[model samples]
Target: MHNVSHGLNDIASILSNPILNTDSYKASHYLQYPPEASAMFSYIESRGGRYGRTLFFGLQMLIKEYLCRPITPAMIDQAKAFFTAHGEPFNEAGWRYIVEQFGGYLPVRIRAVPEGSVVPTHNVLVTVECDDPQVFWLASYLETMLLRVWYPITVATQSWHLRQTIRAALEQSSDDLTQLPFKLHDFGARGVSSAESAAIGGAAHLVSFMGSDTVLGVVAANHYYNETMAAFSVPAAEHSTITSWGRERETDAFRNMLAQFGKPGAIVSVVSDSYDLFAALDVWGTELKQAVLDSGGMLVIRPDSGDPQTIVLQTLRALDASFGSTLNGKGRRVLDNVRVIQGDGVNPESIAAILAAMDEAGFAADNIVFGMGGALLQQINRDTQRFAMKCSAIRLGDDWHDVLKDPVTDAGKRSMKGRLTLLRNRHTGEYRTTTLPLEWDERTAESDWDDALVTVFDSGKLLIDVSLTDIRHRAHAHEG
Candidate 1:
């Protein structure tokens, strides 16, 4: 239930999405010169004034498609001092050479958890390593991607945890403890940055979660990756609202709803707050029950006002008494078909609280759902979830030199100086790194330090499949 914090820049207002509106013909010419080049430029476009935290992911995509190889120093030099004069500290020449050497190697290494994994904060959920030292500086420029990718994944992880907590509460609240179909809703798209990021974030949440994301999420995951269509398998659902002062409105809103979506098993969401919630529940309970049964669809009631705990209890009781007669020979109940999704300021903490309340009131876990938005999506990790590019181990003077960044400030922004091996402990299985003198810098340490770099590419060809899902899964496994 702990929330991630954020800073002002992190929560900046979203930017508008339109490029080159200066002139129609000129804009069209600049924006649509060619398919490949135009595609690359969009990576940096400001979508609705907000770019996803990981701006570099878009850059990576651009580079992969257009640059198509490691950029070489020769390429930089050929730019005739434009890159050098820009005051970029990178050895423009050396980087160009390294790129030419292994640009196709796809030098970046990303170690991250699978799309679905419950991970704690401060856990090294992802570790990205670049293969070439000459291009190590490139890592710095790409911090945006690292941030963007990790943030959503982390948020998704926490969201899933919240869902699990809700399920637990509903089950314990019920008399029979039957599991319920909790449809997870994705309402974070508009609040998120871009179409691409929203889609990606939504898809990341959907792989092991559920939601409605921007279009590209489906296109990228399914059309491009050939993965299953990412969506909740549930049929249809509903919406509702509640208010302060306890006025509840059970407006035959259900009738109008059925007129649109229609019938049994059809999904309907009713906001139950216009007057006294309990009174509204007692009055409308029978009608709502009859409508759901008659339509062959399920009813989804949403409580947007009042203490979720108290409101849920009152409504549950009213619902139980009205629909109690529908329980059949096996003691199974018809209310089993209904879902109570709680929202409006629901977050991980509030979710935990409501869950505890449901348990106190004997409501089944599977009988409810949750729609998490602002409180959930807007949360940011503020512990300085940092992963900086460091040259810990480098080849020098026929041996690798160990490097260390003396502490610069309270930020702990020091870089490693010598050649180091990031090794996995065989016995404890935790991460440990060792510094080695450059002279003995072989493929690995003689003392058996595991070589962190695997042959991702060889002879201009990829040596491994580099499956994103598989890699994500491996990273998730490392989370303790």
Candidate 2:
């Protein structure tokens, strides 16, 4: 966290000066897609299905971070001095206009698929346009900031995929599917690159799952999306909490957790692998079973190391054998009062494997949960889903020009052209991107697809302020 604060200060001066942006963007005003380009429309899309195409997240946060702060004269002076010292030419005129006319707020309109929609790959998720002709370059300039949305969007999509995977397993193994929302927990705050990254990426996970240890993510959801207490965590103990009691009194350590939080319905997670996991489980199943059952609260035993699928299956069998089990409506055995959580080596792939194995073992999915750290928030990159933002269309003085990059080297890198509209194929409910005129009206035309993109940001104001609850609801709707 300290590292992040210092890093933010390092770039604070440059970010404050909007003109200190990329050099190629400086020529964008004059040298555009074509000589007559007046308005440039760019869109963001995912080209792969590794994480699915749920996107356009973190827009509100991007707006608040870059657009809300006013560019000041002091910032301009600092930019001028910094650029001149480095023998670089600064866009003085551009910065002046932005400071005077735009009042530091971006003069751009952003249309996006509502956050949490399960969009398909190779479909546009967001479109950006600038109303001011002189600031047509602003569309792509904002891209520099807005493109950061890829991180959160990717994280959200990955988490959503995990949710779908869990839901499917729960449907197969558990009669009660309501616990799906809490199946995957976020333990990635400490594993991410920075505090801001943790907040954004963690909140993205919350869009699908409700379990999280990242308090800043909850704060971010509340601050950016009007959410209140968007995610939750349980009272838990780490290895230190157990080891500090010594191996001789290990049972005392476990007993202390129950004594601290033993109320009915209270849940506390204990990292049971601090010493010998099997030995600890043996003691828990034998010496501590009556105390745990009498306490009325559920105890979540955490296995933090070893092959996740194998360890989880072993833990489930051991727990069920000792704690006893009852068959759910699905005829799958669920633990009587205790559950297992595999926090180690738990990624989307491993999660699927674990669930499948558990199902095959005749154990209910509701008997266990997963805690993911780096894989949940930090392991992925923009290329994981092949996300890209490209200018699809440019309006000349009196004509609209379609623009695209058709690189012969890599066909996969080819981009879409012309004014793009994201539409959902009604029959399949799959999102598709189409090239159409800017003035094309859907009201007067009959089409097989419904427009999926909506105005989210228009000229510095946020048009849509979706709450976290609403987003969760939307993400879950597709499960039906």
Candidate 3:
């Protein structure tokens, strides 16, 4: 038995040892395949779910974080000890082979669609296969780790849909869409599973919007994708800060928030519903009215509790009544001094519904932005997008055979066979992002298809590097 007092990091230097990074059964998979099997092929895809299209992201981060490191004798020894205690067979010989022949680097090649391209569901996002004949199982052995792409992919997809939702609203109700990127702010760092999840998922949200409070995510984007300052945030007040002032001093809290962050043309968000939201609105419009007007900044009022659609409209009306408003040149009402940001229960559906309600009520989409917490990061999973990585083909001796799984229980779960090549759909090209597949290695200069899948990694080294700036640009390429 392992000692309970020992920390997880003490059990093993998990990051350095790729051996302990997978399912327990994976340790025994080396012996399960036919002895003659010389190579294996696998592919990852979104089987189809909430949205028909998925914005590819975070593969560069994954490659740098996991696959780039070479294996060592120490990792093999640690893995053997772990599998022994857990009653699983160890692949000592295979690990030794990798260390000796490949200098501890994984003898596998990976092909992935560029990180920012949007591809339809039921299509290939990444493919993997062994580079060395003897280590064929290495391709699929990495499944447990490689399949983690689903999280960032799912988050990016959800964020993109939200972007589209906001864009539609802005087009109909605002004179310009310049504010679309900052419309949905990320307040989800503290609400995610771990720091790593916060970083990955937070960076995913930045693919569409530039607002985030997850500092680690910005750091990660710079470290992994070579982009510094991937997102931005401003001084914001939380419930603790507002409520800590005591109920009687609520107005004092609002005043302090402005004094600290309300510089010229700046923006600060303050939670305004600690006591009575309507009452707070009254104070802002009357006693503190001139203070706000002379502050030379935007006061973004946040309402923490209520039905979002109703509260957002209510908040907008109150702010407008106090500061007054003006119709822009395009004829939509714009708030003069203050704006509302609905942070409670702000999901994609609720955001769309809120905007639709505002449009119906003669309120411009610019009158309010949104701050999403749980819904932005933690409220999703692999099944949210039906993500899967399945073995599609295998090489035995000199022969290649198509591999697949077709369950009688659910045809939707049927897997792919042979190998795949991701190519641009030349006929329906928009932003050069539309994708279609062909049999493996069929792409040619003679044909019109531009190969979207790239050899991003191989032999434990990063072959192709794409930066976060490049990814963000590609992700929004369709916006033009």
Candidate 4:
């Protein structure tokens, strides 16, 4: 191997190393655990936040990307040197032991609810435990990384709730629910913090919809989740493209968009709010009205700056004046070949509000869709679902000790205790978190019938493989 090292004054590696993926404080955690603690049992849960449920996802992506590979001696050395200089303790001997004894595969087992399963919060979403007595700290050590899954889970949950809102509106106003999946589009790639954030959060949104402009998210779903094309986008124009033409020639830019992309039976979106949004609407409502009709493709009008609900109501009325509307079977007006896409300031509340206002105005839900950006991907935090991973139980010699924390200050911060497993009722389908030995050993008859948890990873090997298609099917199963 070529020694491409820059000398001691060298910049730290920007490349991803499993050793450096965590908070620096985590490097000293091995020494902090109980000395006699032979093994740790920890579980992840969403304590409840913006939503009551979470769409558990992105775990397979994490496992395939980080844990499947073996740890290298070089990694240990690099981490040691970095931590020594950074004023933190590094568990060198423990990491070396992992390399020597386990050939670098982390001696831990991970079990989680099957990916794409939407379960209520305050339940076990994932559990981790050390597979070796020597690596008792492995479970918590992985917390800093494992908890990152909350990003995708929360995104998926938000997206799923958006889907429910859209579906309800469609049911009330439209003749069919076929267009529901594409109703909430992902316009969030550039709005997020990182490319990986775009990728994972984008993929999470794809759980409920097929409409997205976030290309890397489509690639991630294809690469990590075995999808051919998990999401899709139509030819659309941004503000830069429309504004590139001088302000006086706004209609010409809108005309050029149609001339370029409006093929028979195709759909295209154009951002119309670069200048005077209503003025642009006036131009489209008259000068380009005949051109839009003759093109034989759908023209999605996007209003980029306004109160989404109010703007949607006004846009629908403007489009109705331009193009005649026919009432659907449900007695709501559906605009012919023209639709509005409200992309500004969209979130769960705004989406529901827009749909409700549409219902009040006798407009069909099919007359509009939403394009969500920051709110869909980057606007949330771990506390959006109040996610936490805590050691609930530990093994010391022959006895298992149950552990828990009930903070008197905040009852919401209280935690559960046990070597835990989640079980579902065969008849009611409600889930319950129960202790292992009592449930798995003594009450095996009941749990064996309906254990909701599945072991997906064991001893650094992925035991069960899942695909995007299967996950999508499971996610949509409850809908019909």
Who wins the lDDT comparison? 4
Q: Considering lDDT, which of the candidate structures 1 and 2 is the better prediction for this target?
A: 2
Local distance difference test scores for all models: 0.44, 0.81, 0.86, 0.88
**What are the per-residue Cα lDDT tens digits for candidate 2 across 1-480?**
223322333576655555565453343344434555667789988878575456446777776666666766666666666656566566667667877897766677888888878777888888998756666777786666677788988998888878888989988888887888899999998999999998899888888888999888878987888876888889999999999999999999999999999769999899999879999999999999999999999999999988888899899989988999999899999899899988899888898999999999999999898999999889999888888898887777877778899999999999998888887767677766777643555653345567788988876677788888787777777676
Which one wins by TM-score: 1 or 2? 2
lDDT tens digits, residue span 238-272, model 1: 33223322233334554556556656556666665
For candidate 4, what is the lDDT?
A: 0.88
Displacement of residue 33 (Cα, Å) in model 4 is 2.4
Model 4 misplaced stretches (Cα beyond 4 Å):
1-15, 440-449
For residue 122, model 2's alpha carbon misses the true position, in angstroms, by 1.0
Candidates sorted on lDDT, descending: 4, 3, 2, 1
Model 3 lDDT vs. the true structure? 0.86
lDDT of 3 by residue, 365-406 (tens): 988988999999999999999999999988888887889999
**Shift in Å, residue 440, candidate 1:** 15
In candidate 3 the C-alpha lDDT for residue 52 amounts to 91
Q: What is the Cα-based TM-score of model 1?
A: 0.62
lDDT of 1 at 51: 16
lDDT of 2: 0.81
Cα lDDT of model 4 by residue, 381-470, tens digit: 999999999999988875779989999999998999989988777666677788786434547555444778888988779987899888
